[model samples]
Target: MSDGFECFKHVGLALDPIHVGTGGARLGRVDLSIVRDPVTKIPKIPGSSLAGVHRAYVAMAEKKYPGCAGQGQPDTSGAGGHCCDPKCPVCTVFGFAKGKDSTTGFTGLAAFSDVHIQLFPVATREGPLWVTSPEQLRIAGLSIPEDANADAVYRKSTSSQPLNLGWLLLPVKALSEHSCIRDELNKLGVPKHILDRFGVVPDRLFSHVVNSNLEVRTSVSINPETGAAEEGALFTYEALPRATLLFWEVTCKNPKHFKIGNKDIEAANNKDKVHSLVKKAYPYLEHLGIGGMGTRGMGRLRVLEPNASSNHSSEIEQSDKDKSQEARH
Candidate 1:
């Protein structure tokens, strides 16, 4: 079990909508559909998608540190062998392709789980409000705010009523006074700046909030010669609006016994290195993004790290420790 994978590290991403697309046909409606949960129909960033993006970014950043003797450059051939070196951070985290791998047996040490919407943004009668479902909060290991309640029509806030977001109206059905959800969110590690605008609503209203709040976009393929829209090239798509807070977890399997040649890999060292590299690569998400439509400005995002505002001073200190460890190597 010592070498088995476990949730050694956790990371969150607050995806800012810039017109992300995941292409899906919807009978006669929009030309493409943003990825959504099958049951809830809420837009989501798949874990696989996030994992691939992180791996690529890590690879991109490693270009500078190209471990040992230039083992950092990506396998341009899509052929393996280029990153066969066991100590290479990129291949160590994202396993090498079959038939092209580290001579010392190792599976990708990182495990990425799908990101679920934590605080979904919606337009209401009162500016903007972030909504969370009982189920969702449970999944994220978060507690539902006391001010929120479930109702036939909405999970209305008794103390803080919603005003106007877009077209929907949140009818306040609760009458009891309660504290704002911000303090609770602050304790849970959501930044104050973001929590100030986000609030917890009932699960009953989540579907409406997300579906109605989707950012519908239009695009066209251009004719290079004419410099105009290609004939019948116009297409419409949906995207999860900006400022959507989605969270997922990543587990690093410190495979200490994993041997490269005759030496057992240093699981702690490798774990620390991979964690640091991933954190170092986060700033790139704001520029690159995930999902689809990079050229059209879709997919830029910000990965949330544990920090003081999120009330994780200890965790941040741990990251600082990791940096120190990384520097030594």
Candidate 2:
């Protein structure tokens, strides 16, 4: 009962469109549909997907590829590919399973929450704007005035004219000068241009607006035999557009409380250590990208650091200082 669990919030900007597909074609507008939240109908990046990619990247970074990257294919001797070594950063932070496991598995120290859209970008007559909803703002720990009109759009701009969000247009109401939403977004390091064009729609319209404005493209498979587009091979898919902002949470458990196949984890002895090890793989994510259709120029996300007011900022700053001191030595 050390109360050693720590939660950290991560924000990311999509450098390219992201497509996390639903595996099979749906009987809808697009042949390949992206995964979506059933309740809200808003697309999201699943925690399982995040965990899998992070494990692969961490393994690649440590030069533990193929073995530590996935659920190890057991040999005739009944051994797995995972190192399952407590001291290995890849295995320790991500956990591992071997054989037909009952006693040979650990669920890992880091748990990821599904990534959700925070600010979705849309094209408007004025210019491109980032759209959000009251619920989305609340999830970011910001709130609009309780007495504010729910059916009207609120924006940081002084313009009182109507605004267009995708194909739908609504009359804009100026955000109260005292509203803290803008200030909070600034603290989160949102770009000035995006903040200036940000608009808040009612929660009811959020899903519609987001889905309507998704980036959809049509593509056809090429026939290897003829070196031409294959007949009846045309398909379309949708993705979360670039310049969109998203947020997710990671909960790190103290390594001292767990054991991996009779070995104690010493490299990541604490929650912060475990968290830092996972974050080290973020840069690889930025360059290598995540989700599906990466070869088609999608899924690049730039992870942003927490600001000074963030709950975990002090720990991150201290970690940076420690690294600096070590470098000087």
Candidate 3:
């Protein structure tokens, strides 16, 4: 039988480029706003978001090195050559669109360890303003003139801050339980070494549910009483589960202030902090392969480390036998 449903949590993990300062952490705010139980107000980190961040990072890596990434490649059309049916091979197998010509199936944008590594490009006077200011103006259903001096309009609509390159540092508070990722390990029969090294938190669970599908019907008839036969069919589909989390961060820079020097200095400061945190979290990068094959791309799998720390360093250290095996190959 197939495995049952499972939920994962990030509990207590903090990813940084994290600023300890009052101003927004260089990496922004790490807010794990979703709790485990809504009634009890327990919070949990979402696995999907974690996966998404990893995928993004993968994509970023691919961009840095082209011809390095690709995804599952299956001939979508079936033997029958049917067109656009629900069970049609293309629609069912490939989903909506085909992937790019990259060699790797998985993009590196996922958050393997809830360690959020982000970059803030330098923002100029117009840069930060553009974040809030409209690139184009719109009034009612029609667009407003571009030359209409919309700066004032934007100011009236929302406050401004200098847009510049810098990282925001913040902490993410996520709760975990035994069931969250353990179930996956159980199915995969992960080795004891892997289980121990991965920092498996037994029974860490989160709240997530897929709702039932809604039903809708429609019928049409030509003449009121005279003519009358009608036929109908039922349409059914599953509703997937959706998850959400809140985020917040404090910053020293006033939203009202606009200083080039501050923006430049802050941008540089944040960038440095973010890179440092990323280096630290690099050690856990290999755990992303918890369930299946690790990182895959063009004829190669790059097992990497985020960085090192004395605290969890021993936890992720490799065995001599494993190292010798790796070296031999």
TM-score versus the correct structure, for each prediction: 0.76, 0.88, 0.19
Off by over 4 Å in 2: 77-80, 99-102, 144-149, 177-179, 309-329
Ranking of all candidate structures by their lDDT, best first: 2, 1, 3
Sorted by TM-score (best first), the order is 2, 1, 3
Clashes counted in candidate 1 amount to: 12
Q: Return the lDDT, model 3, position 91.
A: 20
Q: 1 or 3: which has the higher TM-score?
A: 1
Q: Which model scores highest in lDDT? A: 2
lDDT of 2 by residue, 1-329 (tens): 24779888788999999999998999999999999999999889999999899999888888888787887656778666777777788877887775344357777899999898999998999888888887787776676555345666677666778877878988887767323665566567675456556777878899999999999999999989999999999999999999999988888998888877676887698898888889877998899999889999999999887556632334444665898899999
203-284 per-residue lDDT for model 1 (tens digits): 6677777777788888999899999999988888877777777777777766574655565554236565556755655777
Q: How displaced is residue 243 in candidate 2, in Å?
A: 0.8
Minimal lDDT window, size 10, model 3: 205-214
Model 3 C-alpha lDDT per residue in residues 34-116, reported as the tens digit of each score? 11334422232234433333333443432411111122333454222112222221221112223333222211111233211
lDDT of 1 at 47: 75
lDDT of each: 0.61, 0.81, 0.23
* Candidate 2, RMSD to the unseen true structure: 7.6
Best by TM-score: 2
Report the Cα lDDT for candidate 2.
0.81
Candidates 2 and 3: which is better by lDDT?
2
